[model samples]
Target: MRGPARASYRPVTQRLEVTFLPGLGEIVADEIVERLAPARPPRPVPGREDALLVDHAGRLERALSLRTAVAVFLVLTFDVPRPKSLTSGEHLPRIADAMATSVRLGAARTFRFEAAGHDSSVFQRLAAELAHATGLVHDDAEGEVVVRFRRTPRNAPQPGATRAPTDQAGWDVLVRLGGRPLSARPWRVADFPGAVNATIAAAIVRLVGTQADDRVANLMCGSGTLLIERLLAGPAATAVGVDIDPDAVRATQENLVAAGCAGRATVTRADVTAAGGSWRDAGPFDLVLADPPWGALHGSHVTNPALHADLLRVAHEVGAPGAHLVVLTHEIKVMERCIREADAHWRVRAELRVFAKGHHPRIYVLEHV
Candidate 1:
């Protein structure tokens, strides 16, 4: 009986405490949690109060303290569904205090706060209050704070501080569309090129796992957005974009050239529904990405259902087995139906609900099985 086969256990070493602001979607909050605790299981009970234990790589406990520990507080504020004011300042400080207490208990010495919302004044006040409470001087030079909240039990002086990424870079560059300069504003309700579009584009690049040299296509490539992003990412193997709008095709070409990727990418004027004949010329592509118009949004008078059906038919015909197909649209039911009708042994690897400009844009990633 070899001593029960010597059970092996990995140490539960890294721990992080996170607080979610009211009105932020649970899904987005959960993603933030996952980034911190990649291996921790989901909370077992609903509405239970406990510090979240996240396992980031490395020895994190020694790094904990008021002046020296590395920790961040993320606050997201939005309108509370309906019957609530479109904006409010009532809960901003309360949320900030809640997060501060969490980090204090965790023995984190240094603190950085990030507030995302429509109101800038509320966040500024909250930051001032947090700095005052901790006795940490706000270091405008580095855009963070260093303060000794309390001496540890061992009388060990807390370590010095380092800045959080958000404090430095502001926010992650989630997506780039059609060579537009980066923006920090939220997406609008009536149009595209909002946060939702940026997020979906970033997700596609992340989930599809494309190399710098993989040949990619944007079938029905309106404005050549998807193709432009791919080129910005790297010198892809090759990129071919197609669209029925000659204006859109021309714009795509111009954007690619301006981005210095015209040589690696090309745009042609062709309707995707009739893509079979033309797309064959650009065969053996590694990926196909598109954001077909959700009905009249792309300036077409066609109904959403009809457009969805046509896009799916074209995708099935053009996509090779195992090729990645990434689509972003607002027509949830119609897109689902299109995937079903394809019947080409495809599997949906991921789906995301993006809030842009006021409409919920859903993104679907289908891989041919």
Candidate 2:
């Protein structure tokens, strides 16, 4: 009768490792260090691609919530005297013991195996062998325990804990902390055709930076990912989003509502090129973020060039002096030409390459002069 005794949860702190998309590891690393201060300085795993291992000291789930990386894992390392011995059946029991121990550490009931591309066949065989040795069913469908195998780099760091037997093998077993990637935001209830990846959006907002009272604008704001991410990054005086398509505008509205920023953010349907309007009266935002359509993906190829030029000009006019603008696009050549030829008074501040959904887009940060 007392509201079911009020549900509660106690946080668990543990040391862990994180892996992100190759090009974006540094940003993920910075975010992690800023959010959760690790025991020792976080280090990029030697010879490992896009991995940062740290001895963290806070609740694992809390630390996971603070990061935007693709995956967080409880790491276990094994030694193989001979790399070729992996294919032999001799090490099966030891590998199974390591996996079973990792599952217990992750507190998962059922488990699955995931390996990238060609290594999948090797992992499948290893998974079967481990299942036979440990009596754990290999359930790929709804496995709560996710056992991922990785070929450890030659110089990978030693494990922080001695629970798992460590010899001198070149393999690492990582049990994923969450079922899904942290970048998949829950606020994305309504998605537009080419919505920006939420992790990339968070990175862009971090690069642009913010204050408690800065006014922000997002042009071509499809599904409002950028705006929602910016809002989450920090408080703002006002946030506005504009798009030419009514469908996009509606989608932004829905996403904003889902993100609980409906009151703090506004979305309108209007051509961004036509600058002198009521939108301009709101005038001179402290930051402007744009993710214009790349010609090859959703919109037609012809319109993007003109749209890019117009976006620069309009952003220049609507941005306050010393304001910042961040733009993401795959049409780098065209955008570069626009920056060269346009009358807009702006200078490129920084540029970063980020991979998203099979397309490599460059994010340009510009400062209003």
Runs in model 1 lying further than 4 Å from the true structure? 1-181, 184-196, 275-279, 299-302
Worst 10-residue lDDT window, candidate 1: 169-178
User: Model 2, range 1-369, lDDT digits (tens) per residue?
Assistant: 456676676444454778766667778877887888775667887656567887776756555665357777777665754333554666565456545655554535566876664246665676666677777777877675677667766544455744433333476667776556677777888888888888788888777777998999998898899999999888999889998889899999998888888899878888888846666666679999999998555676688888898888889889999999899999999888988886358889988988666688998998898
lDDT of 1 by residue, 1-369 (tens): 456676787764433333222222333235444344455543311122221223444343322311111133222223343212212355334434444544444424344432234135644454466566555444433332222111111122234535322212111101111111122112221222211243345445655665875878887776565676666655687689887878677766776666566788778887777635555577666688888776444634357778777776666666677777888887788788878877665679888665544677776888867
lDDT of every predicted structure (CA atoms):
0.51, 0.76
TM-score for each model? 0.51, 0.79
What overall lDDT, based on C-alpha atoms, would model 2 receive against the true structure? 0.76
Find the candidate with the highest lDDT and give its number: 2
What are the clash counts of all predictions, listed in order?
A: 12, 4
For residue 129, what is the lDDT in candidate 1? 66
